[model samples]
Target chain A: MSNQSLVDAEWALSHLDDAKVVFIEVDEDTEAYAGNHIKNAIALNWKTDLQDPIRRDFVNKEQFEALLSAKGVSNDDTVVLYGGNNNWFAAYAFWYFKLYGHSDVRLLDGGRKKWELDGRELVSDVPSRAATKYVAKDQDLSIRSFREDVLKAIGTQNLVDVRSPDEYAGRLLAPAHLPQEAARIGGHIPTAANIPWSKAANEDGSFKSIDELKALYEGAGVDLNKDTIAYCRIGERSAHSWFVLHELLGVKNVSNYDGSWTEYGSLVGVPVAVGDEPGTA
Target chain B: MSGCGAVVGGVSLDNVDITNQAVIQGVISSGNAPASVGYARLLDRNDEFVAEVPISKQGEFRFFTVAGDWTIVALIPGANSRTPVQATIGKILDVDIAVIK
Candidate 1:
């Protein structure tokens, strides 16, 4: 099935009890889910659930299958994800699921923030369902990028740094208030463009209009025809941008550099440019 | 404020001037304590809440500040009291928070 990238709160509400639909809440703060979350929603921890504890990368395929199976998520189920931080962790989960070849995942547009702001129902009660075996395909590398790929794309201008201007300029490594998405050094990959990830959303945490989105990216010289790699401090924010570009805008060759600035900025001998602008080589 | 109006990290660029600031990045973990939910509060030297964000499952957190020393306290869910962690920032600082349970 061709996955619909975004679903509204009302749609999610109506489908909450549907057998074919499963609701998952991905949050950085693992305790947020336990406090009060959408009824029947299972929580996915952005850190422990998504990553391999022994490695710096994601969990392997067996672990992925087991996690889904334990959560009662079968291969054919349509997974709906929503969470805190404007769905930052949700988008990251969306990307992670897609990486493991799940084809029917969708994001709850505006996430938990909008749901709470709109006075939607939230329950502390958890749901338990009989576990189902989930068969996962191999990881899809096409939607993910590595540091080497970013290095090769230097000067091509297709790499987009979705961090703030100060972080992009080397004036700051990250926002003083947002240290969770920080790196060791400030600046951006050479030849990349600075298009802050938040531009894709509206004041209410919902996405901007389609025309507005097209104009926003086009204004930044991000042509949809060519391959594009979007990155932020780590990867969650950039996954939001990736969802906008690849899913909403239907751009063909967009990938999230999940390693992002955390990896690119810490590497030795990798060229980086500092200034308000993304200078070319 | 004089640049093309762009929204950055949920704030409008027209309002924020980041010409000079320091960044502090770190992960907050309790050595053997169970993972807790909630946010970490960034405090000034006088112990005021300057800013806060939810702590990650891996205990990751970040903060941006002017050039100076600062302190933070974990606001984990179901925990009695959180010990304060400290850091100093010039341009950038990496200080991991290991909460004393």
Candidate 2:
């Protein structure tokens, strides 16, 4: 069954004080929330709230439940997410909530940028809610792929590398200025096709229309009927594509390789292909 | 383990004048809300990418660099506020900075 996908800023503003609706800003930098945020919004950092601190993975079911409970979110509450970086991180968090079976989640259309551009109000007043127990469902593994899963799908023509052209071709380790985000090596997993994540979004940081998204993926040879796996340097960008294909375009069998290039690149033994030098593989 | 030295990999963090290198660390604030997943980018004076690190769970992030006057910008995933702070990297640099959102 498909979930309701997006909520516009107008819808969000009207429901600011709804008891069963929770607005969550999943930003990379926590500081953004402290200064000014959507009124009655609670903050969830993609790293600390969602990630497994001890491991390079998402938090466990218990951790996820605790986070929501502590944040006053009940399983019945509608969780709405938005962020700064064109909603890539927000989309990643959206994918996380979905994997854990939160069925009522929605992404804020155009994210925080569109909201602000329209002259919406932001506040520094922190509102407290009565905490409720949160129940987390078992993770749906079909939507998340690990390294072993990626290995099994190698050379299958459905593994999509959703990074920039430079990253796909190994022209740069990471964004030149963002060196700390680089992987141990350059290049993508063997047999993965290059389909940068930015292509799925409009210039305004909102997703493209459904027809446009469908054509974009089909043009990239992403078969909606077949099992597809998407990856990026750190899995966040790929998650954006994952949302576009699976949620927006109605692709049924897509999985996000959260380990992505960072894990794959650091591996000791795996087939890697750099795209710039054709036939190098 | 919270500074640039602890963020190791992709580049060799070695051979700095032990007395001259400093650590830049701080919370990436939006307002009173702090974030844990964004990055702090260290750019050369010419606006070139030098290095970046993810913000920590406690809303803190860091970078290690040699003594120099550098520009540091905070980046959140969807925001494009590029309000950068001019940081002087010396023996030890402690800063409280914000990400332009």
Candidate 3:
């Protein structure tokens, strides 16, 4: 289903007339991104620029649009999003753009690690200057998942978790960078599936092809045709799943949970599924 | 919500989530030579501890969820783990630390 699943580092290097998109590495420290990055990739502070605690959600529409314009993202630019792991933040950026009406976007299959590991070049501290107008078409809820849908889909649809074993088990915890309780009250979704995001990539950080990817999903006992919903910490990692299912597997009925665990795990009341150390139901 | 420990790379995590987990990955370099390494967790941002982790055979170090947003300063101890060697911290944000050797 991929027009081209693996967008090589060289493509990114050679295709750019000017570094238009910014690579936002989300963490507590800026030193690393400051040291070296994807040339024009700006270090986006997720907390400061991405989310606003006061609103308890992604920034408001005007603010969000302004933020995009401030970042120099325009309506027609084809953006490439990526980050450290599954390019989670990059996926978030992708989701943000799509949510606000932009669609010409894609994620760097392996992200910074893959790029760096492959001996691709790196850029440090120099600010990239390329400005364009990013416009919003509509908040396509179709591309995103909501708690209500997740709650309704609990038994009806399948929830595919791209996190690790610890996360699936109540014993392991995901880091919630919010002002609320960050731990899960229960374990995974009822009778849900677990397929760590890293599995999509090989040891070297390149994505597997349609055959290899299909083999991976089938090996996990996951049925792509069923009603499926993907979720991760804040929906960042899951967006990768959305891309994989839709773009790779051609799986329809796929949605990504926007609130993800941050809201679900912190809720004072919800239908939670706990585990007995994660092995039993 | 996320249940993964911490992403060793990327920024702006000044607090820990009580309900979820995340992952953090990075390399500890010596001068210009990147090496696998580990350090003690400073639960409190201001305190230091005597904990050392042998870098994985792959030359990487990680922390499960001692606390989010807790700064990872080079802890070479007598060698200055906070030494300033010009290594990228991760993707979160950027900083330059000059550890006193």
Candidate 4:
């Protein structure tokens, strides 16, 4: 079934009771999240919840299960996540849940920004006393990516870079933004495509509709039917990109680079890209 | 006053300069720090609120210093809560509220 866009905060909040929706906040800085967030929303820091210190790969599954359980999430719950102002962090959580085999997951379109913009109410009282029991299927590897999968993904699934062209071009970069060694090891994967993250949105954080999204991907040389991997600085922005691919555009086989440029670029002996130049058609 | 913008972690901070101490302010939702409504704190250059604001039932918080770069930080009980608070800064910026409606 096509997922309804969570762009309208009130409309999404209205459905909170029908699903086990969780409002999340992911940010470059926590300054915004602390000011106030959507009511009953539990906050998950990207550094803490989504990633382990190792970078790129999924953290231990049991650790993830504990974090999920603490947030009142359960296997049966339909997880609706949001981060910062828009669906970025929500997409991160969406990717994580799916990687862990949580069947139903979605993003709150426009995320907190839209929710607050719509003038919906927010309270910090996360008073849900009921701790739902969450049982991992142990081998439910239905939604995650591994190092080998990404290594083998070259020339298989189209790798889509959601980062800005400057980033893709290898200009205007921070020392810590990406792995220093990535440039020498490799450039864009052989057949990877470049579709900057902003392309998915309409200036505002709200995303373009499915039809528009479909066209955007097609125009960028991506085939919705085949495999695709979305990536950005860390896994967060790419997670948002993947959300659009899977949820809005209805792409079947899509995954995000959990290690992303940081980990992948740092590998001692991987191929690297140089300059803002496109590799090859 | 020049707003204290974020020093690190933003890939592209909308270029709005949100980390200034004058442009933002916040409250800690869960803590024994003894904060109350209308209570406000002055943010250091690092963009952290040294004091706490007592949250109003309506969650409306107004620091004495407005119309400058500032961010409001809510002191939630948990340690990790401080980092995720959404912050913004501009010539005409806003402080987010957790008002109880």
Q: Pick the candidate with the highest DockQ.
A: 1
lDDT of 2 by residue, A1-281 (tens): 12378888778888999989999988766776787789999999877788788978789999999999999998988999997666777889899999999979899987875665455788999989888899999999999999999888886538888876666777555542232332277788777888777677664567878778778877976566768999987788888899888887778699999888878988997888887432223
Candidate 3: segments with Cα more than 4 A from true spot: A1-6, A18-29, A128-132, A175-186, A276-281, B1-60, B65-101
TM-score of chain B of each: 0.62, 0.67, 0.42, 0.34
> Using TM-score as the measure, which candidate wins?
1
True contacts kept of 1: 0.17
User: Which candidate leads in lDDT?
Assistant: 1
User: Which sequence of candidate numbers ranks them by DockQ, best first?
Assistant: 1, 3, 2, 4
> Which docking category, incorrect, acceptable, medium or high, applies to candidate 2?
incorrect
Each model's TM-score for chain A is 0.95, 0.94, 0.84, 0.82
How large is the interface RMSD of each prediction? 11.5, 9.4, 10.1, 15.4
Docking class of 4: incorrect
Residue A119 lDDT, candidate 1, scale 0-100: 61
Q: What would the per-residue lDDT of candidate 4 be over residues A1-281, giving only the tens digit for each residue?
A: 24663435655668655545654566544555666767666677765566665643456678777777776777877666776524556677667776677876667776664454344666655546256667654534434455566667776667887765545655423221211221333245444566766667642357887788888888877767777777765666677788787767767688777667656666766555655444543
TM-score between candidate 1 chain A and the true chain A: 0.95
lDDT of each: 0.73, 0.71, 0.56, 0.53
Cα lDDT tens digits, model 3, A57-171, are 7776777777777777776666766565445566666666667776567667767656655557777656654554545665777877788887787766678877554455554
Tell me the spans in candidate 2 whose CA falls farther than 4 Å from its real position.
Answer: A1-3, A180-183, A277-281, B1-101
For residues B5-96, could you state the per-residue lDDT of candidate 3 as single tens digits?
23332222456432333334355555555442323221223332211222332334444332234454443323434421121222222333
Q: What's model 4's overall lDDT?
A: 0.53
Off by over 4 Å in 1: A1-3, A179-183, B1-63, B67-101
